[model samples]
Target: MDTCTSFKGYGRVDELEEAAFKRKTRNQKIILSISLVLFLVLIIGVVAGTLVHRKNNNNADEVPAAAINSAEAVKSVCSVTLYPDSCLTSLSASNTTDPEKIFQFSLLVVMNSLEMVSSTFPKKFINRADDPEVKEALKVCETVLHDAVDSLDDCISSIDGNQISISKITDLRTWLSTVITDQETCFDALEEVNAALVTEVRHLMKNSTEFASNSLAIVSKFLKTVEENNIPIHRRLLEAKHGSPSWLTAAHRRILQVGKPKPNVTVANDGSGDVRTINEAVGRIQNKSERIFVIYVKAGEYVENVVLSKYQWNVMIYGDGKAATVISGRRSNGTGYATFVTATFVAMGRGFMARDISFKNDAGPQNNQAVAFRSGSDKSIFYRCSFEAFQDTLYAHSNRQFYRECDVTGTVDFIFGNSASVFQDCKILPRQPLPNQFVTITAQGKTDPNQNTGISIQRCEMSPLDNLTASTFLGRPWKNFSTTVILQTNIGGFLNPLGWLQWQASDPPSTISYGEYANAGPGSNTSRRVQWAGYKPSLTAAEASKFNVESFIQGTSWLNGTNVAFDST
Candidate 1:
């Protein structure tokens, strides 16, 4: 599937005018200035980091160095973290130096607190819940609380050892962050049903949130200590077996059968189906459906923009194929629209799936930032999809998403966002950027250090389109702690020797979690890449597996429903 030879498939848009790129430098000046600054070294700050850590005796909360490894374990670790008071109140000394135990206990407190809140829900809320919608929402909360507890348990298992790798701790932090989100999820559902009820639940979950926040603070302290001491971790997760036939079940097969499952609804411009437009069909969808709703889109050129928001649960959309089914828009950030709002197609719901569909934004390079697909999807999967645009094509915006066998074409920051997403066996086509500037494939936007979000490209192919003359780099950190990994991927010669880009000057390149593992091809030579603080040319096999489909997004559990064959190995 070397996509370099032809541009005919997947609704080629590269044939757009070159004049749009000829004088593009000035157009992007403001964005480059704001989004990225020139890399400058703060010599004093770097030097200060090398000095010995000190406890501020003036501060009442600061723990003394002598108490670090003693019975005051929580206080010692709390001193370095942002939320020391929360840590002190929730955790106590057991094994001061054993970070895993400290973290496990902090999360245990969170789980236990949440469990206590749930115990009262059955006795107080359920009987009083008069609305069926409220009752359904409560059921949703019950399951979400259970899942949050399980996430905490997994975090404990992840960091059970006395000494664990930085990666494992990162995983633990990631899972812990998800626990916080789960509480928000429950509250979101409950608020939709009865906003008045949410205040009570919030009060109940307050301590649990504080405990989780404390655990994350402790983890952040460990990260800082590791950086200060230049410590290295030597552990990784065991790789799971791949290539099993059991993923595609009879349920999946039955749904995929030609014309037999028939669409629950169909959208056709010719009025051949029940609906004349995509929105009409989407409007007919039941809110918060318990069953999968399938929509068939007839072959046509749809010029209207469509948004599939959060309430459309378990909805699936499939079409004739990328070339045959086209949905295009021309919204751009230059037109005073924010990048997030300038998307032609948006999917914000959980349990959303799409196949054989093409999302395109025809705005040229001069349009600044135009997005084809913006996804705030959770446990969502896309197969055989095509995302076409000149810039910011696929906005893997938030939560978890999986794109397999998809084609994404663009120039600057095309595949960018903060979602914990994986693009497996997909084609990332790098087109030419506006003149003078080189191409930067990814721009990960992770605002919070404790967020369990990153962009993982696994076993994918990176190719250069016809006009991509200058070398392109892998990615630049849109945020200080942005995480992105290119694993077992094929990089074309067009990639720059210094395999990554930077948002701006003075951005600490070392704080980013950028790495490449077991990658091959012309652009993968580690010698030429940026020698940043956290850049790893190659990750160990076990470490690489931690970012694979299974561990990254737990892809195995949900991807099966898509009926799409994936490389599980």
Candidate 2:
């Protein structure tokens, strides 16, 4: 009986051991499956990281070239045409009335303007190139640009004035640097798209290439035009051979240069380099001087009120640069003066000349009306002068005047009157809180147009202190026969599309003559201009003949000096 019981226990122990082994095998299999999944996940993560890094690197590589190219293209197109070259006519041509220099300088400015339009092509194209077609088109743009560059080189080599002054060379070098940067920017942007471009992109590229081509052609044609129109070098040489303006004979035998100071007069206020105060000087001078009476003012500021009688004929005031000499007053409508017509400098004399000085009214915008300078005098001339105020800056009461290289700034009717006036190479700066109503240039001559009364702005620049909004007008007729013309001037983009505004709807058709001719700049768009019944859209050659310097003001009498030859053209 004891042997049979021991055999049963041994069998039970073996069965338990087999069960344990089977359970261990199942657990091992489950562990192996989890380990396999973890390995796969790590491999996937590494692949994804590598792909992201490569894509970022590619994007970075394309960025600089694209940015550079785009910028260069835009800058080259929109650059100024009439800056440094035109500057030659401003200071260096001080007493030089040579027509050739003036014309050449003017034409050079036009050529320089071609750069402004060229810069926008690349950017416009890039912005439009989101389609597959644009991308395809752009793929071959670099080749075309390279060809264009080659053509430019040929043109440069063909030009005779290839060797310019150091300053000119420096300007060209700066321009080249900018061009290179723009070109690289464009290239980089194109590279960023790589081969994954869409149809829209291809189309945009095509358009851009075409635009670039067209712009380059325009530049080429402009260069040829410049070469052809340049008054021949031989003509300049011949002009030099002729005696200078100093040796030219005058039509009249009158003394051109004013004589030195009188021994009787003693200088009191040396601050203004004057022998006497403006009031004292005017008080002393008699109206009967047969020769021209000139007061040569050295560089200083004169703050006083002045008035000249009608008998003070052939009077002249000359100074240093406008910034160096100033004639200022704070008189306004309700302030110091009893009347709004009270001006800082008032002249009723004929043949009055003022050069290189500032006449300012410092009564802030709060003053409704302030007269900076008033000219009741006929045949008045202002050269390199400035008229500054918030309102009613210049009042050319009832005569004729000429302003050359003058700066006129104000908010309302700054340059207004019944006089015939011509402003050449002047700067018209408008003030803030005003856009369409900034310029009220004329109250007009109630007398007659045949009597020679109008306002002409030639080769001037218009600027606004406020932000540009497309709704400004040139002038409004304050009275019937209000006439104003902007000829060969640069109008600012702040101008509204409509060129004129009616003071009121009741202001009828036969009242004014507002004319613009051959004007350029973003503001001079004729397509959207107002078609008012009174405004003359074009000036005929015969009608325009009335607006020359000699006729506008009787400048022939007083513009000559030892070193200065006044330009009548």
Candidate 3:
């Protein structure tokens, strides 16, 4: 009945103890709350300020004395994150009580650091590096670093001041999250080409990565603070009282509400409505403040790429289902494009929502990595969307991203990235593998333990297509400390008994956090699963909850507003 299933008694959980556990948890929370208040008070007043003058206001921007009084508190907060030294150094100058200002100033510190390092890339890397292959990789790294800097600048600018709207804060978090991914991407590229070059690159770029990580940690804190403090914040979320949004009459007065969606623009192929291409419409949209700009694409196969940049937020692109609406391209890693750069449709904006659309790259598996849909959008959502490709289909690049009721089809490392993302009730289809080859569903790239990043698939269905009996596995680690969880999902029997593959045969990633809980189907057996240090057969109920949408991506709080019907439980 079992293929050498590992001993379960080591971490086996007792269900009857759950009642006592709840009582203990409540007692702990009370004790911790009282202790934190006193500890937070001790961290004030270790301060400095870099003031900027305001044209309209009489006063200059300065750190509040109250924040200075709580200096140790700030450091305590930083201590809980990944890079304490980086967080403390970057945010040392601005000691502000306002969470928004803390977020803004923390981002500014990283932005400046990235800018400084990016300026040196050309001379220090591209020209100085003797190896041609190394120089080429540096060029890609330089571009990505510059993009990260741009994303940081966008995050800082989006926060007008301390008291901005919740949507803006979400934007800030989204971009900061993207910056983390951008930094990781550079590292991934270098490591793939020559792992030896990593030490040199890390020496020069590790500070930037640390700073970006700090910014992400700070934003996460701010979001939690706001939620906990019961601060009245106006978040421009589109929630339908009736679950998924239904078509309302044009005469409805709610359409004119402050943050309601604007009139949709149309796109058609044969001389119709507003525009001929997706880019044309995307180019015309001025930042509509918080109002969502909906682009209704007509039923046609539009053969062009689309991008929603950091400056373009709250945009919705929908179409007439996957069969009729298709956006495709043929760019691939083999054709001089990095895997990240080859995505046919890229979303880097905040609050980006798409539904009933199909994004494809027809370059086939022969082209190496050809991405169909790549997203670094924070709080971004895709519902009933289809991502089609052969090798690399969808790059959930970074941030708190979610995909519900979507179809993702590919051959190798298809649904991959370094993001804390959730895929709920989606179809994960693996294509036919070549003779003597096998299929891998995911290639998670989490490198840092501090990152709240992992690929969590809950209630998702994984199946094979065509004559795909070659063999299949759940995933392989794309980097050290990689984490992925498959819970309450149905797996097809086409999968190999071993269940997972390792990128490094001689030195497998012992820190890989691979696990499956309550998964039902023929392939869900853990009998022959790898006996890695980090692989868990069944997570404790508490541990599994941490991987749920509520804990992993905190989707329960914001997913309702995405207009995508998701299982809240």
Report the number of the highest-lDDT candidate.
3
lDDT of 2 by residue, 1-569 (tens): 00110101111224544455455445434433443344333333444554456567855554344333333322322222213222332223222222222223322332333233234444456466776534433533432243234322323333335433222222222222222222322343355345344344344334323323233322322222322443121111111110111111221112222232322232235753446566766666678454566666666777888888667876767666678877878877645343223478887666677766788888776766788898755556676788888777887664556676788877667777666677766788776534343454334433222223567776678887555342446777755556788876788777767777776776545757777876788888878877777676666644443454532332111112222222232
**lDDT, candidates in the order shown:** 0.67, 0.51, 0.69
Return the TM-score for candidate 2, rounded to 2 decimals: 0.50
387-442 in candidate 1: lDDT tens per residue? Answer: 99987899886667777778999888889877788877788899987887667789
By lDDT, the better pick of 1 and 3 is: 3
Error of 3 at 390 (Å): 1.3
Instruction: Put down candidate 3 lDDT per residue, 405-456, tens digits, no spaces.
Output: 7889988888899877877778889998556777889989877654668898
Which is the leading candidate under TM-score?
3
- TM-score of every model? 0.62, 0.50, 0.74
Weakest lDDT window of 10 consecutive positions for candidate 2: 1-10
Error of 1 at 189 (Å): 25
Q: Rank the candidates by TM-score, best first.
A: 3, 1, 2
Global lDDT for candidate 3?
A: 0.69
| Residue pairs in collision within model 1 | 36-503, 36-504, 37-504, 37-505, 38-505, 39-505, 39-506, 40-506
Judge candidate 1 against the unseen true structure and give its global Cα lDDT, from 0 to 1.
0.67
Error of 2 at 476 (Å): 1.2
**Lowest summed lDDT over 10 consecutive residues: which window, candidate 3?**
1-10
Candidate rank order under lDDT: 3, 1, 2
On a 0 to 1 TM-score scale, where does candidate 3 land against the true structure? Answer: 0.74
Poorly placed runs, candidate 3 (over 4 Å): 1-108, 122-139, 154-177, 193-198, 214-263, 506-510, 555-569
